[model samples]
Target: MYKINDFSRLSETQAAYSAGNTNLLLYDLPQHYSDEYRSYDSPRLCTIINGAKEISVNQSEHFVYKKDKFVLLPPNSTVHMYLPEHTKALVYEFGDQLIDNVRQRVSDKLNIDISKNDSHETFMQDTLTQRIDALNRRIQEIVLENDVNMSFLIDLTCQEMVYELLKIKGSYDIIYHHQ
Candidate 1:
C-alpha cells in the first residue's frame, strides 16, 4: 500500500496514469483553481487527499472539504469550488446506470425500495471510513501499476465505491435527490 501522506508522489503517479487516457477517476492537483458555478451530469464523490476545498452551493451554503471526509454531489446541482495550492484530490463521477444497478441490488437485498422522495435536491458529506480508505488505496495502487487490465480494475473499484456509498445512512436521499 502506498503511504497516504505521500501526496506529491501519488499525484505524480495519478497524472502519469491519466496521461495515457486510462484513468477513470479525476485526480486533481491544482496550484490554485476556482470555478464560479458548474454542474455535473452524474453524481460525483469528491475525496480530498490533501489540502482543503471550499465549496458553495446556490451561493448560500458553504462547505469546506478536507482529508478523511468526502462530499457527494448529485446531478444538476450547481456549485462553485475553490482549491488552494498543492491540493490533491480524487473525484469519482458515478454513471447513472452503475448507480441504478447498485441501488437495485441493495434494495433487493434489504427488501426495501431505495429512492429519493424529497421535493428538493441536496448534497451530502460523511466521514471517510477505513473501508473506503482501503478501497481508495487499492485504486491508487492499481493505477500506479499501469497494468493492461487497469480499466477493468478501475471500473470494478468505482462500482464498489458506489455500492459502499449507498450503504451509508440516508445516502439514497441525496443520491436520488434530483429525481
Candidate 2:
C-alpha cells in the first residue's frame, strides 16, 4: 500500500516504490520513445492493462491484447510496455512466499484464466488505485492512533489486497472461462 508520488524520484519520474518486497506503480510511457531497447531491463512482470500495449521481449515484438492480457516474467527478464498518452497501469510486485501464496489463492478463486484479448480500460486502473489508497488510509489511521497492531493490519491489508487485485485484474477471464 504505497503511493508512487511519495517517493523522491516520483516527483520527476517513476522509480521503485520502496525497499519492500512488493509495490504497485502507475505511470505513462512516452510514445515512440524506445525503438532499440526492447526489454524492461529489470526482473519484473509487466502488464499493459490500458491503452495500446506493445512489448518486445526475446527479440520479438508482440502486442498484448486487452481484458486481462498480462506478461509474465520470471525474474531478470528485461521487459517494457508501450502505452499511449493518458495510459494507466496497475502493477503487482512481490517475492514473499506468503504474499505469493495469497495471490495464488486469489487467483485460484478466479480459476486462473488468462486473457487472449488486449482491450483494457482506464477505469479499472483507477479502481485498483482506489483500493490501494484505501489500504494506505487505513495504515495512516492506525499509525496516527498509535495502534500496537500496526504490523498485523499491514500484513492483513497486503494479503487481502493482493487477492483483491488479482481478482480484479483477471476476474473477467475467470468468469468468462468458468462458464
Candidate 3:
C-alpha cells in the first residue's frame, strides 16, 4: 500500500484520469485550505492520503478525517471542507451508470434486493483496510498507465470497490441513497 508521501510522489508524476463521466484525481493542497461549501451533483469517494480534513455537512458539527480515511458522499450533497495542513488525497467521482450497473449485479449475485432506502445522512466515513487500499492503488496504477484500455480497467476496478463496499454493513444506506 502507498503512504501519503508515496502518493504525493505518484501524483506529481501522473495527471488525473477521466473515463466516460468518472474522474480520478489527486489533490495536493496547501495548509489551511478551506472551502465554505462544496456541492456534488454526483456521488464521490474521497480518500485521504495525508494531512486531515475538517468537514461539515447539513450544517452539522465538523468531522475530522485523517490519513487512510475515506468518505462517500451521495449525489446532490454539499459540505464544507478545511485542510489543517498540506494534504494529499485521491478523489473519485463515480458516474451514475457505473454505480447502477454494479449495484444491480451485486444485488443479483447475492440474491438481495438492493433498492434505495431513504435515510437522513450526510456521508459514510471509514478507515481504509488493507484490501480496500490495494484496490485503490490498482485504480491509481491504471490511471497513471493511461493505456488504451485505461477506461475499461478503471471501470472494472471501481466496480470491484463498489461491490466490496456493498458487502459491508451500513454501506447500503449511503451507496443507494437517492437512487
RMSD of each: 6.1, 9.4, 5.5
Query: CA lDDT, every prediction?
Result: 0.65, 0.43, 0.71
lDDT by residue (20-77, candidate 3, tens digit) is: 6567767777888886543346667888767898988667788999867788877766
Among all windows of ten consecutive residues in candidate 3, which has the lowest summed lDDT? 1-10
lDDT of 2 by residue, 19-131 (tens): 24444454454544333221122223334435555655544455554424444333333444443433444444444553457655566656655755343211122232566
Maximum-lDDT candidate: 3
Clashing pairs in 1: none
Q: What stretches of model 3 exceed 4 Å from their correct place?
A: 1-16, 37-39, 111-116
Candidate 3 lDDT for residue 168: 65
Q: Estimated TM-score per prediction?
A: 0.76, 0.43, 0.80
Ranking by lDDT: 3, 1, 2
Ranking by TM-score: 3, 1, 2
Backbone clashes for every candidate come to 0, 9, 0
What is the overall TM-score of model 2 with all chains considered together?
A: 0.43
